[model samples]
Target: MIVVISGLIFYFVIRRIRKQIDEMAEVLEDIKNGNGNRRILSETHEIVAPLAYEMNDIITSYENRLSAFRETEENNRQLMTSLSHDVRTPLTTLIGYLDAAQKGIVTGRDKDDYIETARRKAHDLKDYIDVLFDWFKLNSDEFAITMNQVEAVELTRDILIDWIPIFEDKQIDYSIDIPEQPFRVNLDSDAYLRILNNLIQNVISHSHADKIGISLSKQNDKIAILVRDNGIGIGKEDLKHIFERLYKCDKGRSEKGSGLGLSIAYQLVEKMHGSITAESEQGRGTVFQVLFPLAD
Candidate 1:
């Protein structure tokens, strides 16, 4: 009788162990089938408990990373789509204008004006292409700025001189207020020129202001440059998105712009280890403030 009782007890224990193993197997199979909700229901603390917890944690972390990656990818796709549409429209219009002129559809002063218009559109297209390429370089981590010690005052003067013809033609009154003392900054000359050119062109094309003001000064180990215009100021809502890629304000004037100027300028500023901000009130004009650290 004693031997029979011991045999019965051993049999019951073996049955319980087999049942637990079957349950664990079922849980793993559920997980394999994409049922992340399933978890092991262990009755007692054992080796499997730690493993179950680790598996759940790993799944959760993986899901979170995947979600973040999807969001980033969607945003990039939207940006690229928008950029393509915006860039293609102007290029198409420019081509149409050139074709008309070539076929003698335009004549006399109309021909001359049409040619000039085509040229401007061509320039606009080129500018858009340049901005798109630069943005792509920035996205791919291929764009780099070579920093060098540059005199802020002299640089400001040169930029002003280059833009004088445009200002004169537009009858736009402009003034440059630069300090007599040299203010040095660490920056890439090409990048800096591109930034200033974009900003000035934006003022001329979008501001519709008769007068533009530029000021350069040094303050507290940094150099500051301000570009201000007395024009139809940007609205509060528009101001927030002025620096976004392919963003344009005023649908009526959208045909005249590619909306890449401010975005490029903003990125170039960051590459130079500088900061840019804007202030504007509707009907009171806008001001762009750029600050760069002085080179050591």
Candidate 2:
């Protein structure tokens, strides 16, 4: 009688194990048919529980990777479309101005004006291409950052010095307040300079501001650098996407830019283990803050 009872117990255990195996097979089939969401529903005490957990983890990773691939594809499509339109439109206008001047359609001062317009449009095209190159280079795997300990205040001063003349030329009032005590950070000096230059360029080109302010301060272990402008500020909706690649506010749509400057700056900051944030109110002003941990 004991032997018979043991045989019965063995049969029941095999039957339950077979059931779980069948379920796992079904889930595999579903996944093969492109149903990435299908998962095995098995109790922790079941024979197949470990296998189920591992398979589920694999599926989750697969799904995440696939989603990322799709997003990247979409972004590439949008970038190409934007590039086509931007390049062609400016090229066409540039050709029109040059053609008018070449064909003598306008004479005297009008001809000179046409030539000047063509020159400006040419410069605009070059600027757009330069920005596009910068974006591509920064995204490429070959790009490298050479980080070293640098004095933040001195670096900021050097960067702003070049911009002083530009601010004067633009007739934009500006102030610089860098503390005498140096705050040091680990950074690629060129990348840091690019970040500052990009922010200042954005203000010069798009902010429509007459006054600008730059200040640097240290609090505890972190250093803060602020770039503020009294310009036509960003709208709430547009501000949310200002850092997105190729994003442009409605107010800046007519402006000549590849819309990649701030995005590149953001990427560079991340690579340097720093953070950047923007604050703005429409018709009031915009301020960009960059922070980094002090070098040990």
Candidate 3:
């Protein structure tokens, strides 16, 4: 009688083990068919519990990676869509104006106005394309900069000299102060020029303020440069994302731009071991400050 009871117990245990194995196989098949949520359940006392836990961990990791990949793909798709719309709208308008001027749709002063409008559109298109190119280069790891130890104050002054006439044309008041004494820093001259240009253009294009000020000075172990404008200041929310790619505040009066200027400026400064920051208040003004570590 005792031998028969032992035999029955052995048969039941084997049967249960086989049943669990079948269930595990079914779950693996589901996972293979892309149901990553399926998990093999097992109690701690079971013989296959450790295997089940390990498989669950692997599946979780796979699910996480797949989710991340899908997110990146979606983001790329959105960026491409935005790029197409931004380019098409400006380009279509530019071509329409040019075609009108060419076909003599208007005469005398009206014709001249059409031509001028076309010209300005052409320039705007070019600027937009240039920004796009820079953004692509930066992202593609193709931007090459040759850093040099150079005199910064004089360079800043020279750069500001070219902007004086532009300020006059825009009827924007300017107060530029660059110390006469030399301040040395490690920089890429062309990159630095582009950085300053983008910041100033951001003010002229976005800021409705009539007065703009640029100043350069040394702060302890760093060189500081500031671009300030008394325009309709950016909102607190917009300010947080101003340096992100393709983010444009609907706040500019003459807000025709590629929405990449400040972002590019921020990146260029970062590549050269510098920092850029902004301070602003609604209905008050905006100030952008750039700081570079002073050369040893």
Q: lDDT tens digits, residues 141-194, model 3?
A: 567878999999989999999999989988999999888878999999988998
Query: Rank by TM-score, descending?
Result: 2, 3, 1
Candidate 1 off by > 4 Å: 1-72, 250-255
TM-score of each: 0.74, 0.89, 0.77
Best by lDDT: 2
Each prediction's whole-model lDDT (CA): 0.82, 0.90, 0.88
Error in Å for residue 285 of model 1: 0.4
lDDT of 3 at 153: 92
> Can you list the residue pairs that collide in candidate 1?
none
Top of the candidates by TM-score: 2
Alpha-carbon deviation at 56 in model 1, angstroms: 8.7
Give the backbone clash total of model 1.
Answer: 0
The residue-by-residue lDDT of candidate 1 on 89-108, one tens digit each, is: 77788888888888999888
- Which residue pairs show collisions in model 2? none
List model 2 lDDT by residue over 225-271, tens digit each: 99999989999999999899988898743356778899999999999
Candidate 2 residue 104 Cα shift, in angstroms, is: 2.8
Deviation from native of the Cα of residue 221 in model 3, angstroms: 0.4
The true-versus-predicted C-alpha distance at residue 237 of model 2, in Å, is 2.8
